[model samples]
Target: MADRETPGDAARSDRRPLDGIVVLDITRVVAGPFCAMLLADLGASVIKVEHPDDPDYARGFPPMVGGGDAGESAFFTQFNRNKRGISVNLKSPDGKELLKQLVRKADVLVENFRPGTMDKLGLGYDELRRCNPRLVYTAISGFGRTGPNSSRPAFDNTGQAVGGLWSMNGYADRPPVRVGTIIGDLAASLYATIGTLAALRTAEKTGEGQVVDVSQQDSILTLTENAVVRYTTRGEVASPLGNDHPFVRPYGQFPCKDGYVFFGGYTDKFWRLTCEMFGEPEVADDPEIDTMDKRFDPDVAERRVKPLLERWFSAYGKAELEAMAGDRVPLSAIKTIPEVVEDPHVAARNMIVEVPVGGETVRMVGSPIKLSMTGEIPLGAAPAPGQHTRSVLAELLGLDDEAIRRLAGSGAI
Candidate 1:
């Protein structure tokens, strides 16, 4: 073990929302790992358990700068920050015993394996819950824990397609489209985190732990805003309306001088204001276009307003239009990725953070959750494979040097 620290180290410890909490993260890929990262960011002592045969598959993805080995993928680094890594082959008896020992001291356990994978490894919730009665077990799955599609494979696109999000995207005339971002995976992960925190709160109150079952399909299902309402109340099986709102017209993406601006006039007042801003006050008087119901017709609204909107928006640039719109009618041009990176407001808000790694600086998005009392701490770069294995085994499991060496030699860790 490293030399012991004094009282000053304890006094200067980072204090955040989840301080004093310990999380054992036995998840990989996106959803489960993201939840663990969020907990770690809030001051949880998160120990990421990986297999000795291979680390998380995400560590081998592309978009790497140095073109090094599989351990340097940016996708893995971005989501797995602020946590410690250790190697453990759960198939081994020693490894299972080690994990049980860690679980006795853990507050939460997160996993994202197939339904029966964990049980095969003997670390299923039923077995592990017995090891620690207060351990919060979070299981993130594909369709769900039990169902017809529960055993099927799933990815972000699969979830999006199954959840009705893709059917509602794109223009009404074109084919259904999937969102560019991995929203399905991200949403599931975020909901998993929320569920974990809720379970943690309940555990504290009741002095018992519970299982949090997160389904990617279920998470994606939650994103179908008005689609469900329209289907249930009006028998409206929604199709692609493109950038326009399904329930409101004149609320879609429109062409600007340089790029495109999204105009969202969801209400009658906003619709009127949109017409006024574009010097098309006659639209506000037309019985066919005045009311919210009439204005919601894409054909009617587009025909009556597109030309006037184009002429008005063409006269001024994006900045001028944005300034004139002034959040009254909700108008702003769609920006590219580079533009988003250089946006002044984004910089001002510290959304893009610069960090030093490999003796150079790399830019990435900062953590969105900002606490007033506990300021953001500087996190170091991702470690190499098995970088902290010896230290973690020594500190948490109280394994001596001989034991660690024996485990490493026998391929048990």
Candidate 2:
């Protein structure tokens, strides 16, 4: 926290959600970064700790438009926004001492290091908890902290596979597919954030802290949805059902004149409205497709509804069909990234933001969490590697210019 007049001052002046909270973020890549990012968004002072020799692996990932010494990638920038970075060589004794100093002040400490990595680094939960008994320590792994597969290295791909998400996607005949994005990592991060916040609240009440164990594998299992329920109730291994749902009729994407428009007439009334709106009320009442039971019948809906829906959507343009669909049915005019950027609804919602980077303005998504009292902090472009190292150390750690230069010279910052 800074003095009474600084930006950090305003950030910590009053309890704006998680204000007065301090987090020492030791995570890397998506899962860890995402958890810390959420805390930062909610008003925690998040200090992202990285190694001095190497930075976050995401910093080197490609699609690097601006050339720099750190090779900071766009991926890193997106997830790591609204965080201050510090470099510490945790392998060194002096670095570990520095980390202990940080841990002493942190209300929460989050790490995604594999099972015993932190223990090896001598910053295990048991050790850190001794330093600050009120610290909420969170660990995110591929499997979990305990289990047969606990020690095995896991990433987003492994989580998706074992968690049954991959099995439930794509066409039945085709092989299981990893989702287009890091769904497993994001899921684990979300769970981690939830656990951290809950623990923080509890600690505030009890004056004690606990560990939060979030497994990517377990988080992906959440996506299994009814798969587990069906299996437990009646021994069944569900297969991928393609574009159509196993239990909903006329509830998927249909072709349009230019592109695809997704419509989910998932109920009897929506089905009726969809049919009448598309000038085909006959399909809505037909015994073969009217009831939920028959609508989920793949062979029946494929034969009867697919062709008719296609023709109807083709007859009307995407916009007209969208207008007709209206709020009567769950519908979306399948938009591309650029279309979403330009969409009036998205703009009105303040989803897109223009951030300053040098003299240029970079376009990105603003924080989604809106506060009624204190608003979300306006974000700037991602910091350059160690961009805030000197300033943060001098301000937060009370290190002067000579001390910083000494730490940097020793390669132990």
Candidate 3:
């Protein structure tokens, strides 16, 4: 038997890709925190910079760990894991200077404020670039730095609506529905991370860093797949189709006796096999509905195939239907969050992990990116407000005990 490697082993080893990088996370809420956390997971020294008087607003979000006023928000803990936190009153001159000092030493600075917010504080990309030419400054905004509506405030729902995501979501008859999750914020975060990495690579070679402007709306639009292409090229506007796919038939969720099962068997062979499994071999052989085009035709499918398939699927239990599938077609029961957390495959992939926080164990979603060399990234608990303020000041800014105390007394930190 071989010894199993642990997250501790991975952390102590030099296999982490971003071992020496320092990231100044001056963002808040989901999008910014998510981006910084991703960098931290990859071994960057991410310092979550918060306002001294008021910490990240996500700390107040609901679903607290232990409940009551003292309990930490699970929402905050999930996104901010594996990052150190420091609070500095950016509005104060002393605090601004302290942040500038930290920024000079940082390789990357990520901020998600409305347009012109950083400029008002004299900490914009153009200003920071002067001090640290190699710093990758990423700004995640609602619209963008330069646009007609760039300055407008936007939340997750606003991004989804403005980006055409809502227009194409939900059933065609129902009102446009926002996605269950904050895809707008998450998508922007992923894009910001990518932009930061690319900028970092360029800075390493050329010693010149540029601003990476990521907009939530723009990010959401990018993820709309072929919605824009269909409109522009084919002159056909895409509409909501519930769980059904736009281009393929028998590629959506179907009801079973126990629960709903989703399957996608788009090809002719799989379709034939599906019909045979439903005890309708003659339907598969029917020349009128043989071809993909004919089968997917709205009138034909709505009147003949869909109802028949739905009835057949409704007759069988989920387990029975899964057995009948037998890998000939793609199929699975729609899993809830609880089911997902307990699933064997999720456990095998280390998608759920527990971290110790404030003397309590908190369960959180694990990092998805797996590196053979680095192994699993170490998961740590999110810091309390200004948790690392003193330590960070001492190490990064060379501030001693007296100076740190003075700054705290003056409300600068």
Candidate 4:
């Protein structure tokens, strides 16, 4: 794999899809911040707002680089890059007014607070839409805004369980498991981003903005399609398959000499190819497993097909098998992080990126979206608390030094 910079100058250097857009990010932790981060990556001028006394709780997350508040949490840096930082004490009257002014000017506002928190602050969508008719107001929460459980506090794991992912994600004999990554939060963030963008476009055309209510549970539920359909349509409640797919046999991971490879040679055509590759051509023509439906049957797969595949798979190492399979077989050796970093495909596509944090360069995952015209600009560092506070207030609200000093003295900023 070749390592290189993100492409930005190949097309129009001055043009970006969201170049003139302004995003106000009043969010904390994973889901909401990640949604704003994606917009910032697309060239929106995003202002990340935090409370003056208590900053984003994620800043204190682990793997701290020990530069005080400037570059403290690597975790926070991963999600909050490419944003301007400002602090405002929302509980204060002056701070509330300042945020209202920002709302009037922003094209989009994203928040992940509990359902009624903003309403209690008098900064809810109802009040804010009065000031800016074209504001795209988006809220990401554990439950929906109007649901019975909307006011209850929830986290990623809560969303997973409530959304039905946790119940069907593990082996039948063991306790249910959450997915390896924070898929609950990640899924919600993706939906929130899509909803916000859709609303922003409609606002531009109609001269009206609408509320985008994205619930973590609702987002995750969409991903549970297969399981939900099985129960509702067939009266069959699907449990965990333990590396096996619901119907496909010989289609999951198998151990090799060095590591494992996921093989999808389940259909009749691919099954014949797999048998030929395994030097067992006779097995491919066997009457019991000749058809795709017969091979897909659970009992037949366990009784006959699995033993033959496992026996063949154990003789080859990952790289040797990959070299022999070429592109004909639907197979891949799972890559470790080191292997992924050095991979030619990843490097050629610039899938691993470096952004500066303090004096050091930190590597993070790159954006997956690759538009011909929208190759990314270089990523910016996450900010210290209120790093652009005075400048942003002055620039956006026309506040001079005396006014900023008074607000600061009053603990409003």
Candidate 4 lowest-lDDT run of ten: 5-14
| Models sorted by lDDT, best on top | 3, 4, 2, 1
**TM-scores for every candidate against the unseen true structure:** 0.91, 0.91, 0.93, 0.95
Residue 258 lDDT (model 2): 78
Top-TM-score candidate index: 4
Q: Count backbone clashes in candidate 2.
A: 1
lDDT of 1 at 374: 65
Q: Residue 407 lDDT in model 2?
A: 81
State each model's C-alpha RMSD to the native: 6.3, 5.5, 3.1, 2.7
Error of 3 at 15 (Å): 2.5
TM-score of 2: 0.91
Report clash pairs, candidate 2: 87-413
Tally clashes: model 4: 2
Per-model C-alpha lDDT, please?
Answer: 0.81, 0.82, 0.88, 0.87
Tens-digit per-residue lDDT, 1-413, candidate 3 = 88777555545554589998999998899989999999999999999999977889898887677656568887888899899999999999888888889989999999999989999998888888888999998999999899899999999888899999988999989987888999999999999999999999999999999899999999999988899999999998878889977878767888888889997876788888888887788887788778788878877877877787789889888778888998886778788888889988899989999976545787779988987667678888899989999999899889999999999888889
